[model samples]
Target: MGIIRTTVITGLLGTSSAAAYLAARNPVISPLAANDPIWASKVFKKHNPSRNPVTQDVCIKRIPFSKIRPELLQNDGPLALEFCRGVWSGWGFAVQRRYLDFKWRGPETSQHLWTNEQLADSTYEKGTAITDHFEVVDKTPSAITVRCGDSPRNQALRPSDGLFEISATIDRQREEVELRLKSCLFSSQGKMDGVKGPMPSWMEELHQWYARIWAETGSWRLLK
Candidate 1:
């Protein structure tokens, strides 16, 4: 992640099918900036960037559809939206290795709210530089997509005008919900898949840990 390019980051957030991995050559990479296919799958596949010198570092994971939350489907307040935020914020705290400022931000629109921001001087990608801006870029009764505005990974690897749109999308189903996290760069050469390198096991573990917790326990917290 080097430079952020132009274009309003289409597919900023979307549902899943793959899991993209973005890690440095060194192991034990930061959890936040590690491999996240939800957003990565959408960015790469939707954008279908070119791989000149670097091969697209991509991975996708498809969650088996599950039952949908009634309140979420009924346009009941902002619980549906907040659910997405909770999943993301949870990861932020883990990545930053700090929880002092990972409080809830409600939501983006007044529809009750769902999003969060923190300037934790986090060690991870965007968390390292900017106050992570995880906003609901797109949404509906069934799905919501969130994007990070100032990810460190994007600014570090992309070429001049090269930018990364790292985001995640949550889709609700009658009995099957799915999540897709992704990271992709838009450079002078179009969309770049990822920096050339395999995501480390340690770094991968960190992300996996957060995701598992989010899917298992975190969702319940948001339900309340």
Candidate 2:
């Protein structure tokens, strides 16, 4: 029998439709700094190894109608709001892939929560579930926080068992919304890795893509 290859198209995490006002801005594509040799080496290995290169597409957009802080929503157009969502989603996806093996829970149509069974199925060779629980720790009109286990991907990676803490914060302001994400992992092999960074490279590229879309369509005006 021939091998069946499947392609998973993990679409952008936020915003669906394009806006109608801000359409003239130029796309941004600045190269990452070369001074960080370690990061550069890892990125190069991940993207251009001798054999297979794992590629994933990223899209960013705003979550329309989200209850953003009134002050922030007052002046920014749809483009800005959607851009925030895209950034959040893009960063969130990177965090998930790095720290957890996530599966959908809470209704097929819902985007929140993953089922325990799904989590169980994603155990590492050492017999550990990727995530324990995802909780909404706090919320305000302008900001929210989501807390997960230290090594949320597998049960083997629990804070009580010397894991780290992971959380994400979304802060909305008059002109923009910032997504601050953090993850700490205490590996079973006695390794400690922590990340407090922006979204991945591909995600940044997607933001540029969204900017282009807004520019081309001239659709950044707020909807009534």
Best by lDDT: 1
Candidate 2: list runs displaced more than 4 Å.
Answer: 1-133, 138-142, 149-174, 179-224
Candidate 2 lDDT, tens digit per residue, 110-224?
A: 4332333332232122222223334333333332223333323332323222211111123343333322221211123323344322335554444444434422222222222
TM-score of each: 0.38, 0.25
lDDT of 1 by residue, 97-192 (tens): 232124322232122122245321111231222323343334445344443433223433234322222222344443333333333323333454
Candidate 1, number of clashes? 44
lDDT for predicted candidate 1 compared with the true structure: 0.33
Output the TM-score of candidate 1.
0.38
Which residue runs does candidate 1 get wrong by more than 4 Å? 1-48, 51-69, 75-80, 88-130, 133-142, 146-197
- The C-alpha local distance difference test score for the whole of candidate 2 amounts to 0.29
* Cα misplacement distance, residue 221 of candidate 2 (Å): 14
How high is the CA lDDT of each candidate model? 0.33, 0.29
